[model samples]
Target chain A: MVVNASQDDPEKARRFREAALPYLDDAYTLARYLLRDAADAEDAVQECYLRAYKHFDSYRGPAMKPWLFAILRNVCRAEYARRKTAPTAVEELPEGGDQTPMWNEAPETPEKQMLRRFDGDTVRRLVAALAEPFRETFVLREIQNLSYREIADVAAVPVGTVMSRLARARAMLRSAWLAEQEQAK
Target chain B: MTCEEAEVLIHALIDGELDAGHAREVEVHIEGCAHCAVLMKEYQEIRQAIAESDLRYKAPLELRRKIEKALPQPQPQAAPSRRSVLRGFAMGSAVSAMAATGLVAIVLRNDDEQRIENEVVSAHLRSLQAGHLIDVVSTDQHTVKPWFNGKLDVSPPVIDLTAQGFTLIGGRLDYVNAREIGAVVYKRRQHVINLFVAQTANTERKTAKVSTLQGFNIRRWSDRGLNYWAVSDLGADELSEFGDKFESAMRANKEG
Candidate 1:
């Protein structure tokens, strides 16, 4: 391996640590959501940090959160590919069709129904069941609280796409919740 | 705005992503339309539920510790500025003070091995970066070994292991730890290995010590009053095999 001279700079490393270390929790959270396992999340986070440290000089952004999260997301995707256990792609349901008609069927008491659907495990399963694009956008927006612009920057999508994905993701989660509720009954 | 249009903007409104005019428009529509109002409330509840739940997983303490421990130690930058040279001169007196306090000897003894290891690795890396891995390129050990004559006080043993898959490429003169040393370059397939040898007065031969630095494998041992360090990006098993072949060939040459 030919070692590049620029990589030996200690000042660069110190700067990288200072800029990137604070995002460890954010990285791990995204990784857990993406990879869906604690140990795999930890491993991906560690690999992400190492890769980030190596190319830190190339990070010319104003904020490091989106940059670090982007790398963590890539690492998780690669890990998912390696494991070959990515959630199988479900066929896209027709937009506002009979398959998910329950979305429009108003519960008699909206607040009570919303509380019943918010059970932690069910919410987690619903989010995890989303396809990769929607799942990533939802996790970034709702869970990580990134703005649409920030989500666009991290996911390398347009802001319009981020908005659409978030909208579709929420719709899917609502449909899944309704379906799961029907199964329970 | 139609109810369908308001539906598209409901999530954006709840997320604060809409501009004021559009947001006010959506608010007005939702207030008058009971269906849009209920859908908006549902989106708000979903977002709030996610925010209030224990969804964000905190990285475990042990994972944090492992990551922190594995972080690479920063390599000390070698600055050749005039100010640093003057600082070094001033530090000579500080060294004497440390010696007077009986701390210099132990520090120097430990530092010597570490400094040499770092120097050898740096030299190996520099040669690769400079694209000058050899002073004289030759596959035959006889031609390569003769090239070092009269240039150094001691000649490093050169051997050909073409039969064993490690083909001797050439030899070069490299400086490590302020002393001239011999770097014998070899190849196993595509991986290049640098074998650094220098004459030393310490005659105690020891078994090879293996270490890794920055993803490179390093093997060091002393034999017959010469110190040998083999550094490469090759696998440990292949490097150890190269070491064994080199050592045995050197011993055989000495006996003959």
Candidate 2:
């Protein structure tokens, strides 16, 4: 089916798409951060969209981004719970098996140069390495530019908790970033 | 307020979560207190750096497609009618042929649905031993059902068996690849069973077929092309009994 289905009501559908489109990428990215797998993240985002569509009738807000994100957050949590139970074959690596060190420190070559962006990639890896809750709060507040109330609504937590967690999450991310900077020297 | 409290509020002030009155109070406090102001600037810089770093992820395309297919379709109409909701979770219909054969007892060339039962039972036991009880969690059936959207094509009927002594722990997205299957997960006195289902046009299916594999007991049955497989490490007799109850509930729901 063409997902961009505005056949019956072009104007209504277009408005929906216009409002929904910008958030889709951010929603999926947040899902990926929460889920750590490409497939599950996609599932979470799609679920968020469907939920948003079904409830679109009830939406009485100036904007739909926060409402949409709240749904995405739930989908991500549910997906995380499911994956936690499912059987997976995890390859064993060193105790702190973060790839940043190995890949960054590896001998430079033309092929590796094509794949380069040592610092940015390192930062990305550190972000992923943070604990799920911390990383999620950090991403939502700092990167996604969501308000504390919005994050609270999305995370299903109190605003006070969101504020505290955001503070701690930033502290953790900053530490991780600093550590990476040190390691790069 | 002391510097400690003011310092924490500095971050909050930057985020604009602080009320106007509190913001004014914090501003006055920070103006009089240089230390808090400096801390506020540091928090702002940290936030700005994070925002400007391009650290935010760009989801890959495959991830987007997979999620789009997996997410739940809106079903405002499906709400009050419980049976229709469960029927929407037609497990057999969603699965690929291979996983369809794995979770249900259908089109088996062999005479033994018993063997299949046993194998499933063993797998169930492994699930328990491994502490893999459920993939999704929500008391609401709607929440649990959408969990399998992309992972399985047929919606496995999620029946809350809590009143029947089997608590509906949740639902999970299961796979047979290129065909998603739904596994309506339930629990009974610490025992977990995955009720794998799919839609099919075939009826006149067996009521009960029991087997044991890997120290687990299983029962397989089908009513109206919807195949049901119940597997547990619980014993053959007990599993058979539970299967009877489950099948009857399903039948009553269907007929009524």
Candidate 3:
């Protein structure tokens, strides 16, 4: 397909690369979360760049991060479908009482306890364990720091859905952490 | 606002996504109700935990280099030739542009093949580095082949060559170029070999061609519309022998 050929001028290619390359790290982070492998994420980001370059003229938005991420998300979905593997399932949350104290009531402080309980690896695993919809929203909001509107635009969902997904994702992570703490005990 | 309404607004408040009026309502509700207050506190804690977690993964340098190499370089427009003029008359400017695009695509596809080779080597190295060489460990070809049935768009022929020194280890779903492909593992004595298989639009059969990257050997060929890339730390002769055995076995399986 001759996508955006009218704007295929040399200057446009240069401009596109300059604008889109800055978000390479952002794209890689999102792809890694979605694809769940370093090699796959890298490949996804590479393809995202090529596809973005082809469709650069269609990008009329002010920010490049979300636009680039939208393409990356599509690329990831295609890759996911090609793989045909079932979505990585999240383990069931632990049962019983809320042994862990709420943020305001904890005696040791939330920051200290969180640092002790959840390391980088733990956090990544927990986030990766989330289902696709919740995982995408959580990564965009929490990690990429995109606004609700931008996330909705990239995910092709409503702002309200983004808010709820983020909420559910956080709740799931909190409960998973409680489960991990319980198991550790 | 009731606690139920307040609970819905709590996430927006933590995310700084709430409007002034709604924020005020949620704040008032939290102040009045201890239960909602604790939920708010927990939400804040979860957000903080994520913020504090070191989860951002940077793209590796090698991958960056590969991407840079693979990006299409702008070609200098040349003067119109006789072929272009004749074709323009026969078709039009749009057709000529499409022809140009097709040529560029061909060049890009060739470059993509080279990039895919680099990726195969990188994947092999990563598997060894992470000690995740195989996802489904087994010696039985029946078990290994079924594992990829649903995982990949195409089922790669899995065969056991233990009698020939190459033993079936397992298979994994690997991403190369832009598509997911099946990568079956094999063991040659202590050396590990990865046989990557992907479906291709090209129908012609190709003889195996050997190349080396970072001291590792890679042999690639296409047969029955399936592209196969075998990579390993084994010697060139031994790896080629493994490839020969694999190809012949696949051919025999097809015939039978």
What tens-digit string does per-residue lDDT give for candidate 2 at A1-185? Answer: 34554343443433444456446667877887777777777667777877776666677874577788887887776775566577873232333232122213211221111111234556667777777576788788776888887888887788876766666555556456545545666
Per-prediction DockQ: 0.21, 0.16, 0.26
| Model 1 DockQ, alpha carbons vs. true complex | 0.21
Compute the DockQ of candidate 3: 0.26
For model 3 chain B, where is the 10-residue window of minimal lDDT? B73-82
lDDT of 1 by residue, A39-74 (tens): 889999999988887778788884788888988888
Q: Per-residue alpha-carbon lDDT of model 1 for B51-148, expressed as tens digits?
A: 77757665654565566555553432321233332333346445445336433221125666776788788778766743458888999999989998
lDDT of each: 0.74, 0.60, 0.74
The per-prediction CA RMSD against the true structure, in angstroms, equals 19.1, 21.1, 14.7
**Candidate 1 residue A175 C-alpha distance from true site, Å:** 3.0
Let me know the TM-score candidate 3 reaches against the reference structure: 0.52
Name the better of 2 and 3 by lDDT: 3
Model 3 segments beyond 4 Å from truth? A1-9, A85-117, B74-256
lDDT of candidate 1 at residue A95, scale 0 to 100: 41
